[model samples]
Target: MTEKEWNGDFDPMADPEEQKTLLSVLDSLRSYRRLAHFNSTHVRRQAFYSLPSQHWTLLSQPPFSVLDSLSKLDDLIDSNAELAEAIFLEGFKAFMAPSLDSEWVASIVPEKYAHDEYQIYSIVMDHLNVQTTQGDMDKARSCVNQFYREWSAEGNMERGKCYEPIINALYTEFTARSQDILDLDKSDLKVLVPGAGLGRLVFDVCRAGYTVEGNEFSYHEIMASSLVLNHTDKAGQFNIAPFALGCSNHLSRADQFRTYSIPDVHPRSLLESEGTEEKVPPYERMSMATGDFCVIYSQPSYKGAFDVVATVFFIDTAPNIIRYVEAVRNCLKPNGLWINLGPLLWHHASRIQCSGDENEENNDDLKYHGHIDAGVGDPGSVELTDEEVVALVKHFGFEIERHEPGSVETGYISNRKSMLQNTYRASFWIARKK
Candidate 1:
């Protein structure tokens, strides 16, 4: 029989090389915290803070303190790296205890993401085992953050299926407003969905018997959308583990972590009618374009081609949203309607530093990732208020036909008990091109 080694081999007073590793891990975690600020995590944190205690109490175990851990780790890394590592390992073990439901996760996750799905589960289990010897809550948080960055599209697609309230709201609004104006029998109305992330909303629009074109900016989202659209049927479901690995204090309910199903969008699903045996025209009018929204519409053929321009959770993505308004105006024919539903959260309009000058909108070769050239003499730095945005739309020849100010319970890649939630008030409008 192999002799058992001493349970405590190292001297309590003597610090070792593990401290170096701990310092490295802490530094990486600090970088992640910085990155989290830039990503949608800031908004997600706001949503977490707004949750009621009852909801959190139902989903979490005691000693759930991500921010506290961060603060403590910061102090330790700055003073005594060895001590920080020890405490971090303890917290990591607590995070990875046997309570997680791995079997359930494997079962619901889409077969297409089998590798990432397995990798997600494997990483947690492997790290938990490592925590028995060495690990950190910060490290776990980093893992979760990485997972989210890679799998966010899948998670968002899941939420899009659950986006019934928004879908119903739009369906009702479109039918009531456009029924008299649009002749579906004579011609399929040309519809354009800008910033169509995963094409779920586009599918919804197509179901209403309109020819739809979805525009997406991100290459990753475009690929994810293609995977989902090609592999899944109209009503297929998949699963995603959105927040199982994060150890952030905002993650108030870690124990409630589990996989969630991505629901499917059926043809004419919003119509709310029973199925019929009679043959119907199949939904083939839907297609997606990968390019900058402002750049694509500037082309002569695309200008004044679409009958309806619908943007949901999209317009605010531009650095200068006025450019978005201009692009929409350029694309819609006279009397065409521009339907929009989203919060006025200008993603790129944050008062961050800009090259060239704030007043210069068309600084040629002034290329940021999604920089919108709002044309010459455009101010590109400042973010406009919701009222200001509407005014700009009106200035661009769009007359506000209907404007409804209300909130919607919406989120992307949110967990049942995680810290991040995307719920916010959305300004809905039906602006007709005059």
Candidate 2:
């Protein structure tokens, strides 16, 4: 459907905070549509040298065959561009539909969320083209990478390393806590996954006979996940080249250009063995929620609401680690389990920067301050050592039933064929509310 002109409208939402968040997500998804351009620009710049540096002798060198190699490279880049476009386009179509902007945003606000004066901004895809930034491109790239990491068959190796222990540990906790579903329509067993990137882990947990909610903060991720979790019709229904935009440390060019058929298994077929397709037979077990992990789960409504709180590759995102611990403790039932698997790669500890209108912005406001690298003062992150985090967990009324430090080694969205690989020796832990 054709988009109505933006009119630069500043429509008001009942809740200003939620309105701001929705706009932020919309902005992120809109920028995603420009992914092909961002990557092509980078690939071309990396593959070519300055014209001034190339003299006739060098250009015409017989052994090198510069033109021949470049000709082939150009062909590959073309393929890469096509693949990148397809990946972003397919992932974004559902969310970016013009109808979604008005309907979804307008419906944002339930009762009890209100603002006397709310001002929210909206950006159409055409306007996003004008406002695209390197940051937006970086986020777009992450969305593509998440497709493989969360849904593709090739990503199973890494997912196994990071996700298996949580599943197994939860199994022990679920059996210990609740013997039967409270309601046939609704399972008494409830699991909450924080930092639930792309909803894959939530899907897995839901398949284990527990109702699970995947909560995420990144709009790019929310859009990407919602696309597949809801829209995909069959196994391997979506295809993407996650590594196509990469320009460094490749063992072979083929590695970077490889295509992946996403979601090796159909989400609907979660429990084939039981004859029921979904873990919750009617597909009611799996759910997705979008917002800050600390803010959403810390609410009164969520207190003691979950049988298990699972964090996977997520704790390091906290500005203050204590807030994370508090929120987890707050939401779990007495003797509820908190299972975690991740490296403490403190996401907020990046070098700080204050630029332009952002000079007054708080460092914890990751939308602007995240990867920028200038400025002085504190980076505004409370980064804890592995030991510190473990002790912190214990301090917050959790008994260390299990703790395996640096045990699971895995990569996030890694190219298996890349010569240089960055893998994390993630710690795995399961603690009970004491």
**Which candidate leads the pack in TM-score?**
2
Taking all chains together, the TM-score of candidate 1 against the true structure is: 0.54
- Runs off by more than 4 Å, candidate 1: 1-183, 233-238, 249-256, 263-280, 350-379, 416-422
**Model 2: residues with Cα > 4 Å off, grouped in runs:** 1-35, 38-124, 127-130, 177-187, 269-282, 350-364, 367-380
- Give each model a TM-score: 0.54, 0.75
Per-residue accuracy of model 1 over 153-205 as CA lDDT, tens digit each: 44554445334444554465457656776543312567788877656666666
Global lDDT scores for all candidate models: 0.51, 0.64
Q: What is the lDDT of residue 185 in candidate 1?
A: 37
lDDT of 2: 0.64
